[model samples]
Target: MFQKGDYTLEIKFQGDMTKKIVGVYRASYFDKLANETRYVVSTKFQPTDARRAFPCFDEPGFKSTFSLRVVRPRNLTCISNMPIHSEELNTPEPGYTTVFFEKSVPMVTYLAPQYVVVSSTHKYHIPLAKQAPNVEYAASIAPKMVEFYEDYFQVKYPLPKLDIIGIPEFISGAMEH
Candidate 1:
């Protein structure tokens, strides 16, 4: 939707267990544009498609504010739209995970990408995972999922914390969150 080198802010909102499960992801212009730039100098993205990249009503006229947090393992470094804010080690079963929370990005629902993953969930140290996934491949070929996505996305991750969770029941392969 945007070209690389272009800058855009995103505040993601999900209706998960938390009413406003939000995270701030950073987006930049890619050398390529999917359809057209909504804004001229800088676009105001409100995508109709599923990307919902950010938060928005898509009702034509609206204004909103947002907040974000990224969680992962302490040792596993994360990348967001911007640099990280804080990193906290958490245990209590979900130990091996780090809690990363960041500020908000400015964008529409359709255009914002609130969900991001720079690596595999097992990489973050899922002590309770029962069995840590052997990415022997995804890890060996590309040790850092964050770096892979950063290149794949053509945009830098735009938040403080980058959370990667593994869904054992997901399709036979890896799934991003």
Candidate 2:
């Protein structure tokens, strides 16, 4: 599967059967300075769109949090929204390891994302619980994103907590709720 976005976003199954996507998820966005602009991301991908991004079931009604797992050769790196639950070396490889991400929160179809390299972003990939939290991405580009949002929105941080992730690929632009 593609490892471009922030969260691990994985799921584990007990049975041995192949799952397939039934439909596609779509979204859009646009600038408002013109006063009538409409923009959207993750647009028309047909019935099996998610597969274009990654190999997985692309149905929406199948709403459930996934236990996303990503494996990378030690030479490379992985970035996700949650902290690593465990790390195990896929034996007999010098530059390979299995990085397991903690389970994600309840998610719906329109609420998920496919990783990519389409634009520039400043995402803070925070790890661990709250209360004077210690950010895992200390040297990340989040500081800039915070500044931009804090000023434009003219509001304190919207959420009690935030976890931002910046990937390097996408056919469309950035996305948000």
Candidate 3:
């Protein structure tokens, strides 16, 4: 490292798919009736896995806003930390689309980033009470919890929205980010 003035850094690179399902990996589900295999891509970056996904300071103390874009097959749906800002269809490649997400609030590298591309067949549905659906139950209680926390701390929730995702393959039990 040399001088420490102001600098603009741009990194362009591709990451290989992980077979063991860690730090941004592909997942597949097989449908017996349809006789097809559907694929989804998801990220699990906690502790230090974020560096494997992209170049960054990769530390909890280093905070920044994140603007994420993903290009994937048109049939899949992409979700990220922030809501979709805009989407560009059929550019650079056929049968693929680019999705741009809104800029996230200032947050640590670990908490500020997430991306998921799910197969169309893997639709999101609210779970029933009998199913012990943690995601659905969390969704129902998040708003109230946030409100209570804000009142207790005397501060508003920092982000425009709060997202809670359920990863069936998560290794750390659960992660705040």
For model 3 the local lDDT of residue 82 reads 83
Top candidate when judged by TM-score against the true structure: 3
lDDT of every model, 2 decimals = 0.40, 0.43, 0.75
Kindly give the stretch of ten consecutive residues in candidate 2 with the minimal lDDT sum: 113-122
Per-residue alpha-carbon lDDT of model 1 for 46-114, expressed as tens digits? Answer: 224222333346642443334445565544444433335565567423555544445556544433433
Tell me the spans in candidate 2 whose CA falls farther than 4 Å from its real position: 1-48, 52-62, 109-169
As for TM-score, the candidate ahead, 2 or 3, is 3
TM-score against truth, every candidate? 0.32, 0.41, 0.81
Candidate 3 lDDT tens digits, 20-137: 6667888776645457776668887777777878888988889888889899888788788788899899955888899989998888777755887876635563233454567768
Query: In model 1, what lDDT does residue 112 have?
Result: 41
lDDT ranking from best to worst?
Answer: 3, 2, 1
Q: Give the clash count for model 3.
A: 0
Best model number under lDDT: 3
